[model samples]
Target: MFYLTVDILGTISFAISGVLVAMDKKLDVFGVFIIAFVTAVGGGTLRDILIGNTPVGWMQDPIYVFVIFGAVIFGILFRKRLKYFRKSLFLFDTIGIGLYTMVGVEKGLSAGLLPIMCIALGTMTASFGGVIRDILCNEIPVIFRKEIYATACILGGASYFLLRKLPIEDIYAYIGAILIVIGIRLFAVVFKVSLPNIYKVEQ
Candidate 1:
């Protein structure tokens, strides 16, 4: 039940993020839906394929598609309001990635993967959708840039692993992981924290 809720919320959040990006790019209705759908499911699809899960996740459950459609409609209807709350949209995207990181870690554990692999999977699941969306929008992938994006996912996955070793219940551990990812992202954004760029050429 927890997993399902997180998955649904994450999908909706990513879908809305995609809608905002599409609108910013002045994409058509079909293009908006396409970007929304891909942004919502691309990460999970890649994760499932890497884990050898046949049919992928969104394909197995049509609810994901419906959620994306609903999110697109909401974005279209409330675009003006959304424009005033771009930061809120970013918050939603952050929460989506946090929840997605947890889901990915759990799925990786179920797949008998190692801790490091699980963390990698979690990061990929949390960030790959945005990568796909950016590519489609002709922008650089945010995850690849000097931002605390994938690093947050990695930290969240690591925190989940550490918390599982404690005496607390698994639910608490999951919540902690989610909070860590979201909090890190929020803190980074608020403080303008970013990874140092190492590839600067002489101007």
Candidate 2:
């Protein structure tokens, strides 16, 4: 149930995020839906393929497709109002990554992967959709920027393993890990903090 909830919410959030970018680019309806669909499912598709989950998650379950359609419709209907709520959209995106990271980590563990591989899978699941979205929209993917984007996913995945060592229920640990990702992301955005650039060329 928890996984289902996370999957739906993350799908909707990413779909809407892609819609916003598509609208900003003045894309047509077909283009908008295409962008939204890929943004919502691309990461999970890649993760499932890497883990040898045949047909992928979205292919096996059509709920993700329906959710993205709903999100695209909602975005289009509320386009004007949504322009004023970019922060809210960002919040949803942050929450999406947090929740999806946990879902991905669980999938990895179920696939008999090691802890480190699980963490990498979790991070990939959380960030690659945004990467695809940005690429399609002709922008630099946030994951490649100096912002603490994908790093939050990694921290959350690490937290999942760390919390598992405790005596609490696994769900609690999962929720705590999600909170860590969201909190770190929110903190970075609120404080305008980003990772420093490591390379500079003198002209």
Structural similarity to truth (TM-score) of each candidate? 0.91, 0.91
Q: lDDT of each model, Cα atoms only?
A: 0.90, 0.88
Please give the distance, in angstroms, between residue 71's alpha carbon in candidate 2 and its true position after superposition.
1.3
Model 2 lowest lDDT segment of ten? 194-203
Candidate 2 stretches with Cα past 4 Å from truth are 1-3, 200-203
Model 1: how far is 149 from its true place, Å? 1.3
Model 2 / residue 87 / CA error / Å: 3.1
